[model samples]
Target chain A: MRVFRKQDEMTVKKLVTYLVLGFVGLFMLLPFLWMLSTSVKPASDVFTSFENPIKAFVPRETQWRNFPRVYDTTRAMGGGFARWYLNSVLVAVVVTLGQVTTSACAAYAFARLRFPGRDKLFLGYLATMMIPGAVTMIPNFILMRKITEWLTVVAPMVDWDASRVVSVFGRTYDAGRLVGLDSYFALAVPAMFSAYGTFMLRQYFLSIPRDLEEAATIDGCGLFRIFTTIILPLSKPALATLTIFTFMGNWQSFYWPLIVLTQDSMKTLPLGLLSFMGLYSTQWSLLMAGSMMMILPMIIVFLVGQKWFISGIQLGALKG
Target chain B: MAQTTRGRTALAGYLFLLPNLLGFLAFTLLPVLASLALSFYAWDLFTSPRFVGLHNFIALMRDRDFWYYAYNTVFLMLAIPVNILGSLLLAVVMNQKLRGIVVFRAMYFLPSIVAGVGTYLLWRWIYNPDYGLINTIIASWFPQWLSDGIRGLGVEWPPQWLTSVTWAKPALMFMSFWTVVGGYNMILYLAALQGVSPELYEAADIDGANAWQRFWAITWPMVSPTTFFVLTMSLIGGLQGGFEQAFVMTRGGPAGATTTISYYIYNHAFTWNHMGYAAAIAWVLFAVVFGVTLVNWRFGGRIVHY
Candidate 1:
């Protein structure tokens, strides 16, 4: 009788724990569920369910047209949905490529090479990470403006027309400018070099065995060749982590792009989405549809690379 | 010849570092120094900069918005402890051998991975006064007398969340906590919990310790280091936060109720063209962050168990 009582008590405790945890878990998912519900909700019927509390989570009739309508009309203004999507992809890809390539080279120098002031230089670089991005934001904005001004001043000397379109390497640009506000050059260049990327990669590089480099050197491989063949291939996991981080970060970046991209057409998706919010504040369905579109890529990436995403964060935390 | 080759190898290393070093100098290092100098000089982009030593700092002291924004910032930070503790509790619960727990963990972490702006937009709609997710529930399910009683006590029912000064900051904090409670912080805690030796728990169980006792004695101390890390990072992040969310949702407002120091700095520099004053605010923010980090290192290091 005593044993049975003990088992019953344990069962009750477990049951209660599960019930509490399940309730909390639902709350975690509540916002997303609400977002999806609102997206499919008809414009007229969106609020009708509010008369019933439990009914709020379910839509009376699903308006799947809401998603397509986002792209069909002027409500998708501020350079349209397509332009913003293209800009986001372009900036994220170029920024990721630049960040990874530069960080890898820097990490290689720090990890394997001996040179004067290397340690001191790296320490100085590490110290840059301590300075928050907000502090540097103003100066960088000023820097961008200064560069644009200089380009404008020198445009006449090169017979360049600032307002005219010019094409190079299948990419179009203003014939008059190299770096200016609302330009892709302004967006991609400043984001390329990352101290955190260099630090993370350098740690990974240090863990790689020295024997591979030594054997390559004996086989008459130059530094460049060794780095291309030996170092990079061996460090694919670290590279992937940095790539995803940089790409995701650039995709989601708001402040810098918001400040820099003054023209509607030049705006990235996140910045473009803000204009949609401001214009369509009353239309919750359209807003939800736009938001779902904005978040779709990230969700897909997270789902596919969930393993790397989780492990990479854990590695970063361990390093910190 | 060998010495010459050794020198050449060093040159190659330096060559490899040149591109990143140049970017660092131009973008990161130069801007840091320039911003520091700009803090003491007044310029509005069209005009030449003029030095005005300590004037900007003094002006900041008198600006009421600065103080209000500072308060808003600190008020937002009140959620940090709540976030850490909440995540810790969730992590402990998640460490159990429950079925479908992996799915539960994924569901919980989903919000954190989604883009920030989307999350904010979701909450903005949720906090809608008339038909929002929150107010809808309150309107239908909540007893009328309870709302009337609260109103009789001088508070409004189904509060105007983002638009009302009284509830804006708290609403933002709630959204932040909800997003972060199951985020990377929870994962860190979970990892730390898994690292704790099972032998200690077994020994405690042998001593007739209950679940609560086992957690308080063995689990808590074992996870203190992770707690320290989370606390420090969260504090740093908290102080610098509110810029993105405020800029998007509130634009720092219902009469500047949600203007954090970061948003204020952006407003001064970009919107008002008060570049010097903005730089001064930026420096002030940096100093506060640095000071808090120092305090955490000094105090947190001692209490954090290995």
Candidate 2:
């Protein structure tokens, strides 16, 4: 009986520890809860705090129409959300794929290939990571404007006003001639040449054990074969980590996309939502709704890949 | 054979890195170098830059707002260390291997995930005095912080936190702290806790060391590496402060109480279009970051048992 009682006490202690952590965790999570609740709350009940933070969770009624309102309000903005979502998805996917490929290729080269200048070049890559992106924003935007000018080997057929055409970017209204996804190239191409991803991946790839590659070489495996069969499989964790990071970053990107994408039809989510808020300041509920929708995909992605997400973060922060 | 293969490998390596190299040069590296050069010239998005050297730097040194920006940013750096203590205490309690840990970890990590625009909007709503969760709660308890009122229980009314000049900085600090809580630091400390050797615990038990002794001796020493990382990252991020939060929340509000150096720099570059002056502001940030990072790298390395 005494032993059982002691065991019960220990269990209670354990439970208390968990409860304390759980409460703190919930406290950390309050900002998000506040967001979720605020998102669904009726406009009348938004500011009123009774027992809890939000009225939706409280006894007050839920307004499901808020979501639809957000969707409708955003659509009124020249590109609407459908366009912004498409643009964000297109940009993020293309940038992630491009960055991953670019990074993997470079990292592989640096890690496995015995080049004379490789170390120096890798060092050069690492050096650039120290420079803040904000510092580079103005110059990069200017550079993109120049690229739009330079990439007229096949001139875009649009006779338009100089303000819209010559400045920021030019466009062709005729969709029939526009092929191979033009905006995709514009946003993704610059990101494909990202150095930070390469620097990180190179460090990761270098940490990989060399014994397996050595055996593959002895077995007469070609470089491509070894990379395809062995290196690709082994480096999945690093690759996944990079993929997730690049996806999230490109997804949430505001400043760069804001600068380059001039056509209202071509706006990405962050820029689009910001512009929408500016235009529709009166529609507080709608603004919150769009904000929720913008970040929903990220939350879904994180929840789905929580294990990998946690592992990747812990690994990157600690290892780097 | 090895030497020839090594040379071939070098050629192949360069070829593989070509795409990234091109992108880096075009997108990031060139722009950064250009910014350093741009600091010496005046350009307003369009037209050629006229070389007017040292004027921008000179203006930054003399600018009153520049000093104010520095003060606001440093206010955060000063406040954040105190802010992190609450979380550290919580982590110490939470780090125990108890049930529902996964749930707790998820809960703590949710805010960081909800960051950028979403989190910003939430805080903005909460900071709204008339219809905010914070004021309603505070009003119920004391009713003084929101407006003029003395509690019958013998308490003086605090000023409007987010609006009052004296309390504006504190309000901003509190909101920022509340947004993150102990999140990333707790995750780090949790990892550090999990990595502690059981042998150390067993040895301490044999030596008659109590929980406090074991913690100070075994846990603290073992977690030094994680501590170093957290501290360094915190210091780095703390100095820059959060741009969007300040921008959207206060717009440097309540008589520039929340105006950070980064925000000021942003205003110059984006809003005011003082490109040279903005770049000069950026250089000041860079210098400060460089100095602090150097100091941290040295001090963090020295204190870190690893």
TM-score of chain A of each: 0.90, 0.81
Candidate 1 lDDT: 0.86
Docking class of 2: medium
Cα lDDT tens digits, model 1, A1-320, are 98799799978877887887889888988888899988998999775645675688888899999998877653336437777888899999999999999999999999988899999999999887867777899999997777756655777565222434667799874322356676787799999999999999999999999998999889999999999999999998889888888998999999999888776667788888888887777888988988999998998887777777777878788765
Compared with the true structure, what per-residue lDDT tens digits does model 1 show for residues B1-306? 889878988998999999888888888999999999999999898889999999999999999889989999999999999989999999998887788877778877888888488888889999988888899888888899899999899875679999999899999999988889988999999999999989999899899999899989998899998988888898888888899988878889989999898899989999988888899999999999889989988998888788
| DockQ, each predicted model | 0.71, 0.57
Candidate 2 lDDT, A95-115, residue by residue in tens: 899889988888888888877
* Candidate 2 Cα misplacement greater than 4 A, ranges: A1-9, A47-59, A146-186, A261-263, B1-4, B83-87, B142-164, B202-213
Query: In candidate 2, what are the lDDT values of residues B136-216, reduced to their tens digit?
Result: 566556534434435444443343656666766777677667655556676667777777778989999899998789879
